[model samples]
Structures are given as structure tokens and as C-alpha cells.
Target: MPNLTEPKLISGNANRTLAKAVARRMSMHRGMSVGLVDARVERFNDQEIFVEVFENVRGEDMFIIQPTSNPANDNLMELLIISDALRRSSAARITAVIPYFGYARQDRRTKARTPITAKLVANMIAEAGIERILTMDLHAAQIQGFFDIPVDNLYASPIFSLDIMHNFRSQMDNLMIVSPDVGGVARARELAQRIGAPLAIVDKRREKPGEIAEMTVIGDVTGKTCIIVDDICDTAGTLCKAAEVLIGAGATEVHSYITHGVLSGPAVGRIQNSVMKSLVITDSIEATDAVKATSNIRIVPTAPMFAQAILNIWNGTSVSSLFDHETLTPIYEGMYSAA
Candidate 1:
């Protein structure tokens, strides 16, 4: 049996705001003292990384919250070094909490000589002595198979669904959920089912990386408010193109709810000039100044969900139950009292 004691939460340089938010939520929801593990992560003159855990973590379950987002290599190295530090400190268990898993899009080979970097990253984490992984919606779910340890892939659908209900309840009758491509139809369908809306798909062809060749609307979107759904909005090319097509096809308004907002390379600029009314994304990746400056971009908090999952894992409960929004009552009702 695993230890039922409260786990030590550690935050990395990547997405510290989110880590702090999760710590706060855990303290409130679990009715116990929860705080970030004191650690000093710094860089040497040659740009090498150094990590030192100030507190004694012997026999303690440690959860390190780090998302490999912008400056991906630095953040990833931070996570690995932190895990190794915790392992050497005699920690009972270490869970790498990577909210936005970078390199996940490279899970497979597109060319004969292309490498599957996702698997390589997974191996690195496992080799670094991480016993488990907790991440949000991965670009490719199969990436979980790349790891030998237990992996819990949480979804942002529940958060998006609740936000939609609160913001668009009055306009539900004219709403439609849209997938930017065929691959994302399943994700779009799930959100559509949750909000009781019709579904649509945008057939898009990519001729090269980060470029959309042609896009076409597959279903009737006439006079409907379209909600475009996708896992990541990297450059905003697909999103802008999809929104343009939906508007051209007679949709009244267009909005988006994406899991990770990897807004890179003129993405904010493109969104500013696009037809999208708003782009709702989770705080999986730390928001940049450009993201904050964009009026149409909104960030939804994901710490509550992550905090609940950490509590469940610590208590040896089912983390998957967090997916069912209807059963989330117990999460707020002191579910960890027995622990």
C-alpha cells in the first residue's frame, strides 16, 4: 500500500502561477495544510541548471508541477533535475505533473528518417526516477504508451463545459461545436454532447508545417454560433482559417476553446485580425504579455481540477472520477478527511 500522508508539492520555473494556484486550491478543498516544497533552481555562468531541495523529503510523496512550455528545453531539464534531487533525497514517490507536454506532437514519424521525440522524452522522465506522470490533454493520447510508469492524462473538457454553460446558456439554441480538422472530431463531439449542441467539422489540408492549404466547412453552420475546439493553437493559422471559413459559410459568431495556447510566432497578431470573437484556453502554458494584451484571448483556470487529482492520488482514490463533472461534489465535500 502507498503512503496516505499529504504529498509535498514543488513548482518549477515553468508555470509557477499555476502551481501556486493548485497549492491554494488543495489547501482549501482538502481541509489540510498544503504548500509548495521549498527548492532553489538556478543557472550557472555557463547556463547549466542547478537544483537544491531545502526541505527533507525522505519517505514523503513528492509531486513536481512543471510544464515544458516556452523555453521547452530549460523547463524539461528543470523537471528531470528536480525529480533526480527528490529521488536522491529518499522520497517515497515522485509524480511529474506536466500540464502542457511539449514535444507531444512529435509522437510519430512523418518521414522515413524522422525521430519519435515524444517517446524519447518519456524515457528520459522515467529514467530520471519519476514513478508516475500527471498531464493534461496530450497532443496525442498514444504518447502515454511511451512511458513505462503509470500515467494519468487529465482533460480540460469539464472546465470548458462549465464555462460554456455560464457564458453561453442564453445562446445555446443557436450554438454549434466545430472541430478544426477530422482528427479533432472526437474532442469536439464530446464537448458538443456535454452542452447539447450540434457538431460540425472543418476539412483542412496542410501542404507544409504551420501552413493550411485549403479549408472547407463540412456541416451546416448557417445562422449558428460556432464554437471551434482544438487541443493546441500553436500559430493560430488553423484557428484563423477555420473561423474565416465558418463566418464565410454564414455562421453568426465564432469562438474557440483550446486546451493549450502555445501562441507562438505571430499567433496573437493573427487572432487580433481574425474573425474569432474570443479564444478561450486553459492556463496549461504560462500566458505571455502578448497573450494578455490580446482582448479576445481569455484564460480559464485549471488548478482546481489538478488539485483534486493530486488529492485523489494521495488518498488512493480514482482520479478518473474527476472527469465526471456531476460527481465532483465530493471533491468539495472534504473527500480527503480519511487521509
Candidate 2:
């Protein structure tokens, strides 16, 4: 029950833009004053990472905002090393605010001789002396069990739904929520229910990663504007294919709102050339130059949402406030209505 008044923010090389945005949003808090820690995370010629904190963090609440996104190994190691440094520096509490848990997709072992890397990552973070974990839209919910410490899994539904409501108000009647696969039905249904839109499913099977079997639309999408909801969009193969399938199913328009845009490999090219109308992703991961140049892909900031969550955690407020449609809807709208 450690109180987090005047929390200290820290960042790694991974997604520094997002870390800065979170700090900026937290600065808007009237009750508490927070600032980014002065720390240097550099490397040597042999690619070894080094960390040094310039300020005193003794007995102060610390939150490391690092998303293990691209260059997953390097980012992951950096998070672990930074947390170790903070713990040794005697920070009162260290919470890893990971926007994108890169190893989350491998939460379970699907085949013989395979390892559950997600659980391993969780163990590493805990062993690094991170007292708590704050992440968003985990690929699998049960991954929470892998951690022995307090874990807060924040939902981005409010942000995404409010955005949808603002931008697609005119098409609310004609809009439909679609799950790319059966596993994502719950996430999609939540958004659909929140926005009062009908739900559809793309019954898809993938023989292997990035290779999809035949996909069929479970609900009639003819003449409807379809919106696909999912957690991660890596490489954009499944997303582009799902869009093609929806278009072939007579969908008038197709757009995707994914939480973590792990746009590795040819994701940018695929997204740009795909039949989808638009691909909206959260700024959980830093946008690449290619992603910035793409006209069809847009990024929504998650800093405001994380800033609120971090504040609540410190104030002993229930994190469930983030899911309250009546309360959070207006806040999200005000934050991103113009965008």
C-alpha cells in the first residue's frame, strides 16, 4: 500500500517519445507534481548497455516507461537493466509501465519443445526488482498470473471507442465492429457494445504466423463500414488479409483500430498498399519514419490514458474508473476530439 505522491518518471531508449508524452500529460495534474528523472542509458562499442542516474531517487516512487517493441531483445534488456539500477539506487517503488509487452504473444507454448517466453519476460521483470507492472491490452489475459507482484492491466477501449464515436458519428448506424479472429471476439465485442454497434467476426485460421488459411465473414458486412478491433498488428499481414477478406465479403469500407502497432518488416508498405481505408494505432510504440510518411496510417496518443492510470495507482483510486463509459467518455473525447 505504498502511496505514489510526486512520482518520478524514467525512460529507456525504446519509445522515448511516448515516455515524454506521458510525462507531459502527468504534468497537467494539479494535485501532484512529477518530473522525468535525469538518467543516461548509453552503450559501448561492443553493444553493451550502461545506465547512470544523475538525480537522487531514494524513497521516491519511480515508474519506468519502456515498451519492449522493436529490437525486442535490446529494449527488453534495457528495461531490466534500468529497473535494476533504480532498485539499487533505493527508489521507494519501481513500477514498469510497459505500453507494449513485446513477448506477450508467446504467453503459452503451442508446440513441443517450445517455451513460454511471455512468462519468462514476466519473471525477468520481477527479478529485476520491479515491484509492480502496468501494461495495456495484454495479448493474453492469463499472462497476469505469471507475475507474483501487483499488476495493473489497463484497457484502451475507452480511448478507441471515444475516437470511433467522434470520427464516425455520422456513420454510427452503418458502422459494424469486427473481430479479426475468434480469439479477439471479446475485445471487439466490448468496443461494439460500448459504441452500440453490431458485432461481426472474421472466422479465420492461421496455419502459421503470417500465413492465414481461408477466412470467412461470420456476419453479413455487405454495404456496411467495418472496423476491425485487435490488440497487436505485427507485420500487417493478418490485418491486410483480413481487410481483403472483409472487402470480398461486400464490406463497403474497412478500417482497423489496433492497440499496439508492432509494425515490423513490411508492415508500413502493406498498410499503405492495402485495401483498408485507414489504420489507426495507439502510440504505444514509437512511429518509424516510414510509418510517419504513410497517409493511411494514423497514431493516437496513449499518454493521456497512462498518465491518468499512473495517477490513480498512486492515489489509491480504483483503476476501474478507466472503464466507466459515462465518466471516461468525455475525458477521452476532450483529449482527442480535434485529432
Candidate 3:
């Protein structure tokens, strides 16, 4: 821990509930204080952004809590302005604590003359005087290399693995971990290994973004309960289609475990009509109204894990242990309530 005495926690409008949760977790220990700036960000008639931070925080160890989720442009600009304010006010060190790092999918330029927006976001953060970054479950692992500052890219797999072990333990023999796409095979494999289940993959060809033309099942899903795993679920296109494919392939049940639920467009409706029995998502990003209304969707909190990571980082301890399987068993156990 880096002298918790002088650290001042501040939050923007991105995810106040998560920020408060993190603050409460930090407050569990003595001698640390937290604050929030009146960061009311609004745009002019011409679409220009204006940000104002109402608190003064000079020469303090500042942590700005903001997630670049939906309305990414506004949230991102708010974060940048807050960072600039802290820097101008002479904060000793500034850390951008983003539970969900957006624009992560744009890590590479697949087409000619296209932009790598992920690197651009990193540049903006660095330019805003962010000394460090704390984020979770980046869409692409390579995005971490885009940042010059110390970037801690956390994983939500441990959180999900624990939840599955507790709720689906009795059905362990029938369970199969599925990668919704070939790109996420490693993530699916990790979860499969943790729960001692078989692994499968969904081979799909994309004619365009958010559209899956066709899917082929790579492994046996017949008469088995399948759990589709992925880094993020945007439109829920792949998940719904994959679930349908699994069901058609003799799967008895279909469920999804995704790290980030960037549920945009018709995702909620898609999941509602799909064959999926349930869709489990972590609260890396706040749940939208549509998500709340969808009966098939469930949300698990990541506050405990994130808070533990923050504690370990501040204490100058090993973060590797946080990623270890043994350390995460409790998270899933907690998911199962007392009967």
C-alpha cells in the first residue's frame, strides 16, 4: 500500500454506484478519505463538451473513478477533463480507475486508412496527465501495450468461474464450456479447466459487424449443458445465434458467461427470444434499463475483486495471487446464498 493516508478518491458521472462501492471498500480500513467532484459535463448546442470539477485537490494522491462505457465520447471527455483538472491543481499522482475500458475492440486497424482508436484513447489518457491506469477485461490483450504508463488489466474470469462452480456444481458432469468464437478459445479454456469441464468452440463467419452469417460447432455439445463464454457481448448476436446452434446440436441447455455486457441495439430483445436459459454478466459496466427488464439476464458484482486489487496495488503486494484459482474460489461460493 502506498501510504493510504494522503490518498483522495474522486468520482465522475460514469458509474457512481461502483465508485461508492469502491469507496466503501476502501473505507473498511482506517485513515483513508474519499471525495467526489461536481463533475456536471454538458455539451454546447454545437456539440462541444464542457466539464467542471467543483472540488480543489492540490498535492494529493488522486484516483479518478470513471468507466468509458456507453456514451463513451461524453464519459471519456469527462475523464480527460477531470485528469487535466487534477494535474493543474498539482495532484501528487493521478490514477484513472476505469472498471471497463472502452474502445478496446478498436485495438487494430484491419482495413487500410482505418484508425486504431484504442491507441488514441491511451494517448489521450497519457496526455491528460494520468500517471497510471486501472482497468478490467480489455477486449484485446495487445491494447495494454499501447499505454506508456503502468496499466493493470484485470480479469473477470476468476469471478465467473467461482460463480459457476457453486450454482452449477451438481450439474458439473453435464457441463461444457463453449467459446462463442474462435478468438475467445483461451478464455473459454481457462474457465473450462477451472471447473473441470470439456471445452467447445463456435466457428462463425462474419459478413459485417454485429452480424453472424453461419455457425459450426467444433466439439461435442450433444445432450450436454453448454455455457458460452466471451470477453464482451455487444449486440448479443453471436451469443444468441450460438445458443440456437448449440440447442440444434442436441444441447439440453444453453447459458452465457460474458465479462462485459455492452448490450447495445436489439441485444436485449435478441436474448429474450433466444434459446439461452440465462446470461450471466459482471457489473464491469452498469446495467441498462433493457438489461434490468430482461428476465434471462443476471448480474454479478466485481466490486470485491476490484477492491482487493486496489488494496494489493496500494500495498505494493503481488497482484498475481489475485488471479490465482485458489484465491477466487470464495467469490463463487458467495454467489450461492444460504438455503
Candidate 4:
């Protein structure tokens, strides 16, 4: 068996907060050490990226933490160069731990001339010497099939599930899981099953890209508490529009549990003015100033779960239990009571 202990953690500039938390959690429990290589990512005259690994990483099992979020191309290029450097340094293995895998929304070709960028990203990582991948709640689970190496797709729901249990214990009876789109029905259904609630879907027509949505609800949500779940919340357009439809359908209160908050242009203002009671997102991507300032937005940390998974991987253990839906209940109870 491969030795899993004493793995060294290396990270890029993306989501440094999450990487540090994962590193700190694992090091404390496993007594392993982590070293960060200063890449100092900078742009060249032609807009290309330059990276230099500042530390020696020879003969180490390396995990490079980088989320391919905003400035996606640049951040991705940084990750590739860093991985190639470690590979050249004779690292035993290189694992790319991406809390948020960007380009995932482009997993399939929706129309003629459209490219599947998600597959391309996977190919790029594989070519960059990543022996394995560790990512969370990919926009499409099937995207893992695009990777030739082993991929461990982690879920934020376990983290979110705990939060829901503790924060809404008294209101569980009236809870209904709502999928903002028809495609996300499965994800919402999984969450609904975990929390013991019914599932609802929003039927919306897309008139044009970047335009307002025309929504029709699919389930009876009258006088009930609604929780909208999705993989990513970008621009907050879909979420805000869905909330309006749900409220109109008689939903008393609305909350959201989304994995990656890609809170791009106007997202903060939209959510602040929406009918949502609160919006909870994971720290997969570094929060923008607007995200932090928004009062109704609460952030839940995935550091513990991620830390535990890293430890287990290093120790040569099964990580499937980490995906168990029930594991989040007690963890949330603890956090809820403590908070």
C-alpha cells in the first residue's frame, strides 16, 4: 500500500484561506508538515503567466491547492506550471486539490460549435503531471469521467446539511428543498432526502443569455420554508429570479445552500434585495468584499471535512464515509450549539 502519512501540502494563489485551513487541520491531527512554494504569479508583456516554485519539493507526496475560479485562465495556468515544477523535482505523487473546479459548467456541448471546456481542463491537469484530483461539488458529477487519473469529488452538502439541521431545527417540518432549475433536481433531491423534506423545482424559460427569467414553479410550496440548493451561484441572477417565483407561490421564507459562491457582478446587490431569508455558501472561493459585507450571507467552513479527507488519503484509508449523508448531522449540531 502507498504510504499516506506525512504528505506535504503546496498551494497556489487561489483560495489560500481554504488551503491554509485544510493544511492546518491535517497537520495538527496527523503531525505532518506543510510547505508553501511562493509562485508570485505575474503577467508578461503578451499576457502570459510566469511561475517559479521557491522551495525544494524532491521526493515528497505533494498536494497543490488551487481553485480555478475567477481569472480562471490565469489561475489554471499557475496550477499547471506549479504541478509541472513539482513533477520535475521528483515528487512521488502530485494531487491537485481544487475546492472549486472551474470550467465545469462547460461539461457538454449545448449547441453546434460549442466546446466541452471541462474535458479540456481535465486533459490539461493530467498532462501537467497531476496523478490524482481532489475537488468538491463539481457543477456536473459526470465531469469526473473526463479525467484519466483518480478523482475524488467531495460534497459541501455534508457541511451544509449540518448547518441546516442546527440552524433550522425547529422549522424542519415546513422545509422544502427547491432546485432553481430542472437539471439540479437530483442534487436538491439528495439534500431533501438527507434533511427529511419534500423536493420542488422551478421551471424557467430562457429568452436569451443574460436576460431576465420567466419562471413557473413545479411543487406546492405554499406557506413552507424553502431551501434552494445548487453547485454554483454566479451573478445571482437565477437565484434571485427563483426566489421571486417561490415567494409568489406562497413560500413563507427562502434560504439558499450553494456550494461555490462565484459572486460576480451585481450578485451581492441582487441577493441583498431578494426574498431570501439567508444565503449560506462554502469558502471554496475567496469571498469578495461585497460578499463579506452582505449581512444575510453566512459562510460555512469546509476545512474540517477537507482536512479529514486529506489525512485519510495520506493514511491509506477509505474516503467514501466522508460522503455519507448522515455524518453531517452531529457535526452541525456541535457547530450550531457552539455558535
Compose the digit string of candidate 1's lDDT tens values, residues 86-161.
Answer: 9999999999999999999999999999999999999999999999999999998899899999999998887788
Question: TM-scores of the models, in the given order?
Answer: 0.96, 0.96, 0.92, 0.94
lDDT of each: 0.91, 0.89, 0.84, 0.85
Task: List the candidates ranked by lDDT, beginning with the highest.
Answer: 1, 2, 4, 3
> Which of 1 and 3 is ahead in lDDT?
1
Evaluation by TM-score, superior candidate among 2 and 3: 2
The clash count of every prediction, one per candidate, is: 0, 0, 5, 1
C-alpha-based local distance difference test score of model 2: 0.89
> Which runs in model 1 stand beyond 4 Å of their true positions?
1-4, 329-339
For model 1, what is the C-alpha lDDT against the true structure? 0.91
Write one digit per residue (lDDT tens) for candidate 3, span 106-219: 999899999999999999999999988888888888888999999888888877777787678789899999998889998899888877899999999999886678899999
Whose lDDT is greatest here? 1
Error of 2 at 101 (Å): 0.5
Residue pairs with backbone overlap in model 1: none
lDDT of 1 at 87: 95
Better of 3 and 4 by lDDT: 4
